[model samples]
Target: MSLRVQQMLGYTLLSAAFFIGFFHRFAPATFAEPIARTFDVGSTALGGLASMQFWVYTLMQIPAGVIVDRYGIRVPASVGTALVGIGAAVLALAPSFALAMCGPALVGFGMSIVFVSVMKNNAIWFTGQRFGFITGCTLLTAAMGSIASEAPAALLLRISAWQPIFLALSVLSLILAALLASFWRPPPAEDCGQLTARNKKERTKIFGTIRSVIARPQIWLIMLAISGTNGTFYAFAGLWGTPLLVHSFGFERDTAALAMTLSLVPYGLGSLFLGQISDKLRTRKAFIIAASGASTVAWVWLVSAGSATPVVAWICFVLLGLSSSQVVASFAAVKESVPDEATGTALSLVNMGVFLTTAIVQFGYGWLVASAGTGSTITGDLYRIALWLPAAISIAGLLGALKVSETFPREQHQNQPANTQMAIRGQLQPPYRDGD
Candidate 1:
């Protein structure tokens, strides 16, 4: 195959993995009652099920990054994809709560390997500009998975039951995994950076790479923003948004599913919309700050609006979704800040921060809601109080966005010949310059 065709196949398979990762993560939102009934659990217990996925995903972030960089994408990508299929099958046939919980958690472990691996592949195969666009495009695709898990999933549940849907998902994913393992070739040998054996000897010690990323002042600042903005959204939209709508607004389950779908569909579309705009503007910080700031304001309105008409609630949800596109900016910022060689570890650390915050909100927020007497009640007030946490965190995230100072760091490296600049960045820090 031509280099372009090979890279295309690689990314196509990666996108398939990304889609499954998002689908399983958000599937709990629409299936709350089924899950609770099947498992004979309460809100807090159900939240634990969702939390299990993010928590496992969070823990694997650094290790996945290291493994991708230390080994290569091929082995991990194939394994992770197949594991996700297996986990889905387990969920389909799960006979108890314990088994169902194990399913999402196992899927999460597989996903942790998938995302950073795909990102590292992007860094290896594509140029910097293409990388940013692909990042946006990647989120756009993943949001489709989230969307499927919402209203469409509710419709499917009405058709028969949730179990069979997951079973079909299992069969489809295994097929994709087989194709990825068999057909998707690596990037061209000449175009390779960290992906090839050419730079194997120039690799950083594992701890050294970890230290370098964590120690960077800018990375921490950006991560804080990502945690506040994208991280907050994951908690609210991923599992709680539908429940909040039903419990607070008096919408029927199916109606609330549609409203939630309206919200989440934009979350995907806006990534394509705003991400391209960011690319055209050649700025990450400006867009990130604006989007984070806007989303925080929307969140505040949602919490304070108090028992509005369902239409008003739907509008608020859509605004929140559109503004959540700032997440793409976070992805771009992290990718640009590091050398291509360290993209996996760097991006994975940032992902760890986001998922870590999501896990806390999933588990901790449920506990808080339960303790406050709103856990199973239909009181909007309690949900509003519970929402205060993510709103406050988003504020902190916007403040952190102000500290990230890069238009496009990776573009400069692109201008230099691969041998001279890419090699030097792998071994030593580039000359201490502005904002790096």
Candidate 2:
């Protein structure tokens, strides 16, 4: 195959891997109540089990990146996929709550590696200008997976128990793992090559690289935005959005699911569209600021307006989906800011920020809802609370965007290595200048 074909195929397979992995993490979302009832536990206990998965994923992101940096993408991606399969199998067979929780935690561990590996590989294969678009496309698949967890997931639960759903997912993960093993090869060993060190000296340098990324003040701000925005959305979308619709609007479960699905369908589309816009404009920061600002305003209106405006709520949620592309900006920023050699590590740092915040947000939202007492039916209030949390967090990201100067430092700074510039701009030489 031609190189372009190879890259496209690679992107396709990786996108598939991401889609399956994300679906596995999120597909069980609507089944929270079913799992709780099966285990005879309170909502808090059930949520805590799910939260454990996020916590592990969050904590492992940086290390997962390090593994990718030291080794290559194959081992981490392949092994992680196997782990997800194993976790799924375990969850499917679990006869107890404790055993069930183990499944998700294992899945989380495996998933952590998969996410970072895919992103790291993308950095090597794709251009900086395309990062936002590719990130959006990849995430669009992820969002589709989440949507599967939402509406179709609800339907699947009615067809069979959660066991079957997870078992099928496990099989899918294994298949994808095998496909990746067969097809996915890292770039030639000489392209900035994999970070290799013979002994302690190299390890220390790696450690130092990580420390440098961590010490940057703006990384924390970016992290805050990524985590807060993603966490709040995941918290509400995965666990609470449907419930909110049902209780607040007096809709049936299916109707609620439909509403949530409609709201989310636009998420991927918006990301795809806006990602292109960001690339064309050559300014991801402005896009991030605009998206976040819109989300904040839209969500505030959601909380204050209430049932008097269902259409308005729909509009606001769709707007939220569009704005959620701030993540693409974060991804672009991290890739652009760091040394090419540290791409994986830098991204891992950002992932740690995003997932950790997501865990906290989801857990906090769950705690708040649980505290409202059982079966009181306060979905509207729950959503409103969750919306406000993200809105506030997104503002931080918007502010952080103002501080970031480049989306692709080498290109923007006119300092790209010849090979990299050729690969990125699809030409062997920079645009000519008269003097040079």
Best by TM-score: 1
Candidate 1 CA-lDDT value: 0.79
lDDT of 2: 0.71
lDDT of 1 by residue, 1-436 (tens): 7777888888888998889788888888887788788778987688888788899999999999988888778888888888898999998798888888888888998899999888888777777666667777888999998898888788788886878888888887788788888877766666674447643753657777788778777678778888887787788778887777877777887788788788887889888877777777778888778877877887788788786787877887887787777777778778766655567888889889999998887776666677888335546678767888888888888787777766463556667776656443544554444343
Kindly provide the TM-score of model 1 when superposed on the true structure, using C-alpha atoms. 0.92
Best prediction by lDDT: 1
User: Once model 1 is optimally superposed onto the true structure by TM-score, how far is the C-alpha of residue 416 displaced, in angstroms?
Assistant: 7.5
**Tens-digit lDDT string for candidate 2 (1-436):** 6666667777777777777777766654677878788888986787788777788998898888888777777777888888888898997888998888898899989988889888987787766678778887888888888778878888878889887888988898888788778777755444423322221234446787687678755456566656545656665566666666665556677776677777677777776776677777776667656666776676577667666556666676677666676777778767765566667788888888777767777776656665664576555666565555656666676566556544443446457566765543322323432111
TM-score of 2: 0.87
Runs of candidate 2 exceeding 4 Å displacement: 189-204, 372-387, 412-436
What are the Cα lDDT values of the candidates?
0.79, 0.71
Colliding residue pairs in candidate 1: none
Please give the lDDT score at residue 75 for candidate 2. Answer: 72
Quote each prediction's TM-score. 0.92, 0.87
